[model samples]
Target: PAARVVLVERSPEMAGFAHATLAHPGNAHLGDRASVLTADVMLTGKARGEAGLADNSFDFVIMNPPFNAAEDRATPDQLRKQAHVMEDGLFESWIRSAAAVAKPRGGLAVIARPEQLGALLDAIDGRFGDTEMLAVHPRPEAAAIRIVVRATLGARGKLSIRPPLMLHAETGNGPAERTEMINNGLASLFGD
Candidate 1:
């Protein structure tokens, strides 16, 4: 009922599992609308390009790439450098790939640890126009653990830094009402 969707996985076994899981009646409607590809992203640059995944072809690019940094030089045909180096240069390749395939005015959403925010920003290289950041804190007084950032390609604008979202209650027992409210807000934002 909608446009096509593509799923890329590095493992064949995982790809098969995803295909099987999506083949159920509950998801039968997605037939022919989705495809699963088993390919190592770091070594599939040519394949990706051949598949018409050229620059500015997508409306959005979302990824949660591996965070290990010690395998950068182990592969001779890696398409991304940051895929292996968490802090060395892996993110840059991912961002560059996203930017290359994202439409000129498309958007990007990435969820990553708070510590990676600086590296993410550096990789964006001003290609992102407007950006909004949401920090997630464990408790009212605890520091942020993660962050969600939404950015647009080629659309320079001001950054909107919203207040931190607390994930736990003030009493530190569990999630409080405020935590629920924050969760609801995020759900609404994502049209859930």
Candidate 2:
């Protein structure tokens, strides 16, 4: 059977955008394999289950939760600010939800600012293991802008950090080959 996806979105506009994107002719197959549920992701496991996120059912969970500190320069737009700013306990809540829904040995992947890696790891502790992180740098000499973390539920393997992914060429403005490949969906952070 084809893999099915259940997307949870809190914003009506985003939900509508998701639906419209899926409904596009080029994405008909994806639409057939996916469904969108409009709801708060911060809800309790039981509440989420009631909203169609059954516990111990999903084989994989991926997220790009807001990681910006409240003190970070806020976006002028309220909606964008809300989407980019992180609230207290956000990581814990999201990871708790991920753990609840994922089957044993299920995979969890997250994209976050490099500074949030510690918080993310702490939240995953005792729930997901065998964690690996890949740093995303804007250029060869620049500090990492983001990190992609991957882990497996119920596994005990030690954490590992993968090679950094450079988005831009060492000295040029254009994107690196790998970055282009990844942007085009031809590659993955996990090298899978």
Candidate 3:
């Protein structure tokens, strides 16, 4: 069954496309069990506030936010601050919002690039407890390119690193395993 999810995207085109492609198919079995909301991460007041979402309502919050350092460099300017820099602290705001709306012991999962790991950890530290890390390697021989992290609210625990997930084929078979995982929702294999 699909859990209640609130997906935020800055681009309407990407959001709508995601709703049509991913949400529709991924939640087909859990009809009316999912809700997809499209809005800019920084400007969405409802999402930032509890009025738009019930307290302790969700089971999980999943996202793959933008990860361009040049675009969101740590700077002091306002526009860049909100857009790229965390001046407006949109990522932290969203994380807090997720923690607020998520049920006790609910999980928050994010897939971010390797470079963003430090910022991500800094942003999430202390706010959400029981953090765990899973590195994502593009190929067996290559360094990890991305990371998958899961954290829960209000509980303290040691961080556990999982085995790296190899996404690309050694012989360059066009990411065979990763492709299947994306196309067929292979995450279900983990049984949550």
Candidate 4:
């Protein structure tokens, strides 16, 4: 709780929702320690500086950049479409932004669709090294649907692929007994 968390989101509506949720009675404990800044981090400048974010100054950077190229959909929500639809060079821009602000030896993480892992690695190739990937699957027997890539800036090392993190039990397995510890924080893969 000693560290401050500043969330940067490009969507104004989403950023407002984050602020409102964090200020809600049940989660108000964040108090003033957490705040959201609406900005396109890829082009952050005066806004970033005002928020105390300087080039190569952040301890780490985490990005959930949009990964899907424009897709045909029925949703009428323009905001949702804008958020999910990706443009050319979006990933590269996001990776560059993270590298620009990350301190030397600082860590960076990007959550992306499984198909984009190669592009993600290429984008971070020079600015971040010692890359590792954690694949996330819906269940132990399912193929990974996404990956979380973690890297250290300015380090030299080989890439490591970690075991997949399964999010659910397989069908017909029945519900595994969950203890308070498990429900609260303990995570497992149904003993798989």
The sequence of per-residue lDDT tens digits that candidate 4 reaches over residues 1-192 is: 786678988788999999888889997788887888887776766666665567887788988887776763435788887778777788788888788788889989899999898899999998899888888777777899889899999988878887666656676444333322345557532221
- Give the per-residue lDDT of model 3 (tens digit) for 1-192: 445446566555656776786556665865565555665544334544533466677777776665556554766655444444333354676676667777888878877788777777777787677888888777788899888888887768857777677777787757657546865886632225
Window of ten residues with lowest summed lDDT in model 1: 77-86
* Local accuracy of candidate 1 as per-residue lDDT tens digits, 63-174: 7766554553465644444344454566687787778778888888777778788888887768886887778788878888778777899988867777777777767567
lDDT of every predicted structure (CA atoms): 0.71, 0.90, 0.66, 0.78
Off by over 4 Å in 1: 1-4, 42-47, 68-87, 171-186, 189-192
Name the lDDT value of residue 144 in candidate 4: 90
Please tell me which model should have the higher lDDT, number 2 or number 4.
2
Query: Each model's TM-score, in the order given?
Result: 0.72, 0.92, 0.71, 0.84
Tell me the lDDT of model 1 at 91: 69
Per-model tally of clashing residue pairs: 8, 0, 1, 0
Give me the displacement of residue 178 in model 2, in angstroms: 1.8
| Candidate 1 TM-score, C-alpha based | 0.72
Give me the candidate number with maximum lDDT.
Answer: 2
In terms of TM-score, the best-performing candidate is 2
TM-score of 2: 0.92
**Residue 23 C-alpha lDDT in model 2:** 87
Of models 1 and 2, which has the larger TM-score?
2
